[model samples]
Target: MHGPAESGWLLAALCAGTGAYCLLRMRSGVEEQRRTAGGEALMGFGMAAMAVPAAVFAPPAWAWGGYAALFGAVALRALWAARTGAHHLHHLVGALAMVYMAVVMAGTPAGGHAHGTGIPLLTDGLLLYFAGYVLLAGARLVPVPAVAGASGAKGWGDRPELARACRLSMGIAMVAMLLTM
Candidate 1:
């Protein structure tokens, strides 16, 4: 059986692993556009790490602070993305949860077990939202015939296969995180 600490670590690993995979896929996309989504995904993993450990072993202040910072950053990024018309439904949900977590954490006291009622709900919601978004991303893929590259480079541009893999892994990771939370 896994302890709470182990669960937390697992959640963090899932987030980090999926985010890294997505980053790699994004790197191979057309024009090699930087995937801020991957960065956000990694940030989520970081937040999960901090929140879970704090909930299990640390004081409320530490837990709440970690949650607050994570959500605060996400909220800001979401707002910027929304304003730029680059927002996706998944990002919007993630942003909302982050903002909510930040506010809740800000209001609660530190070092208390009785005050973590909202954590589970937040985790579940985030999981579903992110998972849904990952599916949507996969469904939206318009395959490119060949991977673009220079001088017969092994790695080429726009690998839809990679993107699909990234999405699947990310979805599974999010599901795992939610269960652990």
Candidate 2:
């Protein structure tokens, strides 16, 4: 991400922390929750790496290709997994977004983002998607009568709010990273 070293570091930390939490969530009793957490963990960690300040450590040109390839594979996996549930569709979108950003970065010259795309349609569309996701996810966080959870001792994997918060954080991180692009 092309930005102040301080802000980039902060973003990286935020993402890394989210990744760590997602890893913990993978110990969930529910198979679906564990599966979802694993995907979120990947996204969180990948975002953290990409958010690293260029001023601190700019990756070599080839590294961008590596990022693209890794995310591309992830996108494919998410696509296949999407058949099982709608959450996987969200994962598919997130993975594709990462791939898009990786390709964009690969095209950017080292030391500066001067060659960055000038607000292309892809970027705009992604911004709309993540922004809308953030809004919808944020709204879901507020407990309402219809969507309220049942009262009882909830296991870590069964905690919908935490999972939603995880997604919300990723959505915010995505929006921030997109803005920098």
lDDT of 1 at 96: 59
For each candidate, what is the lDDT? 0.55, 0.88
Candidate 2, residues 21-87, lDDT tens digits: the string is 8998998898888988998999999999999999889999999899889999999999999888898
TM agreement with the true structure for every prediction: 0.56, 0.92
What's the lDDT for candidate 1? Answer: 0.55
Candidate 2, superposed: residue stretches over 4 Å from native: 145-151
Pick the lDDT winner.
2
lDDT of 1 by residue, 42-142 (tens): 65465445445545555445555666676667666666666656544455555556555555545544543224445666676677777776677766665
Runs in model 1 deviating more than 4 A are 1-5, 22-32, 51-60, 83-87, 102-116, 119-131, 134-158, 175-181
Cα-lDDT of candidate 2:
0.88
Model 2 vs. true fold: TM: 0.92
